[model samples]
Target chain A: MKIHEYQGKQLFRAAGVAVPQGIVAKTPEEAARAFETLGGPIAVVKSQIHAGGRGKGSFKEQPDQRGVVLVRSAEEARQNADRMLGNTLVTIQTGEEGKQVNTLFVEQGLKIVRELYLGIVVDREVGGPVLIMSSEGGMEIEEVAAHSPEKILSEPFDAVAGLYPYQARKLAYALGLDATAVRSAEKFLPQICRFFVNYDCSMVEINPLIITEDGQMLALDAKVTFDDNALFRHKDVVALRDLAEEDPSEVRAADTGLSYVKLNGNIGCLVNGAGLAMSTMDLIKLHGGEPANFLDVGGGANEDQVTEAFRIILADKNVKAVLVNIFGGIMRCDIIVSALLNAYEKVGFNVPLVVRLEGTNVDKAREMLLASGRAIIAASDLTDAAQKVVKALGA
Target chain B: MSILVSKATRVITQGITGNSGLFHSQQCRAYAAECQPGVDVFVGGVTPGKGGTTVDGFPVFNSVIEARKKTGANTSMIFVPPPFCADAILEAADAGMELIVAITEGIPVMDMLRVRRGMEKSSARLIGPNCPGVITPGVAKIGIMPGYIHKPGTIGIISKSGTLTYEAAWQLGRVGLGQSTAVGIGGDPINGTSYIELLKMFQDDPGTEGILVIGEIGGSAEQAAAEYIKSHVTKPVAGFIAGQTAPPGKRMGHAGAIISGGAGTATEKMAALRAAGVVVSDSPGGMGDAMKQAMQR
Candidate 1:
């Protein structure tokens, strides 16, 4: 649900939240053209990736080149874009295996008098959305939260009413803004809160919410993510998703109606529920087997989803064994067994399989699995399933 | 002797014309007949525009007000979709229903937040928007969970996961332990009730002897419940925290099931429960045994 910075800025513009003018470009030439189009003496070429820390990030191929570069000329913009595009960017957030810079944003750099932070998130404990602001903006919020916790200030707001004008003005004043900037913030901050509510945003952070030399408030950098469950209502936000930034296997799993998260282990797990699937993986590790991935075929698994689940697991070369643990409910154990048998035939299981079936019509399911005459190892319970899968892996 | 529901509890079905709604309504009616013959626990159904019609021997009403007025139903089982699910819940609450059990999954958190605010001013108690719903073994079954596995007994259970709730029930049944009442609190960021609220009820109820809590990686509901158990709950308590293998910030199928800001991990929840003198199960496979150990202590 995380949108690119350019996409976020576009949303900001639509919401009447002031943002620095920026053009998203896919090529070095487009970046140059965008720089010229902006007609600014100083332009910032930012690598567009899902992860943060782009300003401090470095390219893997050209380590000397930064992910975010300050360009004084159009030629300098193209040079930085050429070095960044199609190159892997390593940031504090991107980990060792970094993301490729397929897109760049050429923005007009603003002369900031002061930089401050503004964040909005659904605070689970508070049971509503909360607005967070701080004096420390350009730096990582985590560092500010950890070190000088007093510097960061936040307030919980009602979901329907949103952040009150007084609350917005309070934060603006707390950031030590003068009368003009505080008045501007009273309007700007509430607009951002309204934008967050209107768009179903789970999180919206404007790091370095800059104050220009002329005393106008604007979102210098925007990071926004909408609630995935609420995506049905917002088709436009769903279209903003960059599939290239996501793991291909995960993207495929979503399309196939399976919840899959690949992990670094040997035993592949396919279970019915999210909690049970995670618990199954934990049990595998507890029994000396590392799970290759976490896959949930969901509560009502038909033949195709089960087959895709297996095929996805088997597709991983590291997976030494497969564990299928289903605690059947509305979907009977017999029906799941039928799906498993059909999926086994379609997917062609190459690894050792350990199956544990429980709940409604379980006896019939166990009998059917035994009657299948396939090389499926049956376990009596969850722990037994974990032990069998690990034993199958020879761990 | 169940906490919230018994065989005498009257029920109404919301979104009764939908696939899952009609299907589960039929199953629950059948279960009611099987457990207590000719009870007629399911009094009416609610479906807007489908009013003045009879579906499967149940009368459909347009509004919750008419349904409550006609049937005198005390409890509502909702199967409405996510978009209108909040409205359905509020309608039931506004109609003065005692209990509203929402079986609809994928309800937007904002909708639930608004529902929470509205419920604060109303008298109705809500259960789940994205949940399997509650069940009191043999007497009343009010959800999509398979009814045959549960039986009448003493272990009071509350879980965030649906199948894991069934898993614990099945495991407990295997060892000759049956549930007095098992509740699925739902796996959403904001639920109608919390573990602490339910635990307090379980402690006060005589039907529940030993308590089993099944939690996952998400908010600090489990930790809060653990603290409540240390101070208030004298009953033997056992706990299980799922998703120990899950990475931080990854949503594990469940919308609320994620570790963020270096908190709400399985390890932290387990540590909290352990420190509270509750028996925390090492693996999901061992929940039944852990509860037994707690009872013996």
Candidate 2:
């Protein structure tokens, strides 16, 4: 999962990486207090959201207001925070809908001589982690790679062996760092790499890594995402999750062991697997309907989980119809049918519902649904199910 | 001839006493009993400490070595949990099993990385730690796929998703096209096999005339396979990628389903496949029709 820039910097500090002093503020008063505590000539109030490109992002409610504002005094910091908090921010990374800003990072401003970029990510093709550095730092790395490919350099290393000294020195010289900064990097880069390995991180990006006039190097901005599958090993990292930054339905689905992503559509889709859930969404779109949400009840879901999934799907007011598609293998079709029936009885389906069951006692499932005499549309197959759902919606 | 398994393939179950292991093992045995003309493919099982006992009439051994020794099994399917899955794969690899299919999900990436490093000197081919295993219709069923939906035909299928494999194979069956062999290579960042490997296998199989490749967002595997098909593969192929409407930078319930650093988009994959002369369908429900049209051409 993703954490805010302030949290990432905190972890960076704990890892022996240099970062500007910062304090997290949840309200305008707190931001003012943080600004006073920093005692700076200039401070930055950055809106804390999961997405990147926050500096270029603008508040939707106050179109002229930027998400990140630099102010000279505590009153200005408070004003900026008041303008940003509880406002929706639209960024290039955050789709058109954007995300809400609930917290701010008030950090002391820094003096920089030059900017560089450093990142550590798993190179899937290389089957290990790689360190990517570039002379072009403040700009988007992908854009830099596209336009000026010669500026980017990468070193792939074995995680088990740790980052080698020679690898770090080579990258430091490749980025054309001066003698003092190069010496600093020899000590700094490996620590950052160690942080990546120590935290079970999937990605660590330090954009616009700055070198001060005094030859000190520091990370100006950090974005870290940990491996979700490895979270069981690190409870401290799991505690960093922010529920306010996520969609409520998605958070609830995770708690209930269902996978759900809400979309802006009218057709509610329920499928047994991830790929099938996505394929079902595509089928819904193919039949001239938009999917309201993508819901995978998992392979071993029971009646209670199914009922909760139905409740979560119906929580969206935009849902016009429901489509239940199950290709049960380890999960029996009769059990799915029973769960569907139980969910309908509990939730009281008002919209048109289409059900398609296949594999493992499917005849019994179909017979049970037929005997129920409910106003549910039983489809013959996947395509038929899509067509039936689309037709029922009068789309 | 099938690509991976046939009537002569011998199988053993690891984690045989577990719920999923016993259920799928029994289902596979029942399918073989009803469909196979004369071959008994499932040989024995392996479970730690539960060895010397019998599960569903199959002898349970303490280790893969003992199971192989007792049954002469050359292939094994794993249903172990995530924590011990890598160890299980290493055990099978060291025991010299020819093909190992791991059906367990959520194996840590670091574990798999170590396993891949360990397999450098070993010759065993691993299919998945989070996949539905291989199946050759009417001959041998190795993993969790329902056998009733498949039939023997000229099509070879390889997929990254378990249920989508069944969906695509069922679509092919509905169109009167039977499958020669179907394999789910699993949905992880690093897997044992790639689409290029399986495509080469299908290209060489005399009984297979067409291929159905089900790809998704997340890696360069599809683009790599497209490049391979452009130069090497001669069989007619159809492609379907899930998550066409998926948003950028979101993991759609699959560990390997994210579009990272502006790559691995469905649109890009589809274009690559089409450039390689593979008929690619936009909607998965229409994939069988797309393959049928490609075959007719």
Instruction: Assign candidate 1 its CAPRI class.
Output: medium
Candidate 1 per-residue lDDT, tens place, B1-297, comes to 788788668999999999989999999988888888978998879999999998999899999999999999999999998999999999999999999999888888888888888888988988886788888888888888888888899999999989889889988887788999999899999888788888988898999999999999988999999889999999999999999988887888998998877778999999999999999888888998999989999
* Global lDDT scores for all candidate models: 0.90, 0.89
Per prediction, fnat is 0.75, 0.59
Interface DockQ of each model: 0.80, 0.62
Candidate 2 structure quality by residue, lDDT tens digits, A1-395: 88889989988898899998999999999999999999989999999999889999999999999988899999999999999999999999888889999999999987788899888988778888899989888899989989998888999877777788888889888877788988888888888988887787889999989887877789999999988887888788888899888899999999999989999999999898888898899888888899998898888889989999999999999999999999987788998898889889999998999998888799999999999999999998888999999999994
CA deviation > 4 Å runs, candidate 1: none
True contacts kept of 2: 0.59
**Lowest lDDT block of 10, candidate 2 chain B:** B31-40
Cα shift from native, residue B172, model 1 (Å) = 1.5
> Looking at model 1 chain A, which ten-residue stretch has the lowest summed lDDT?
A386-395
Which candidate number has the best DockQ? 1
- Which of the numbered candidates is closest to the native, going by highest TM-score? 1
Q: Over all chains combined, what TM-score does candidate 2 have? A: 0.94
Every candidate's chain B TM-score: 0.99, 0.98
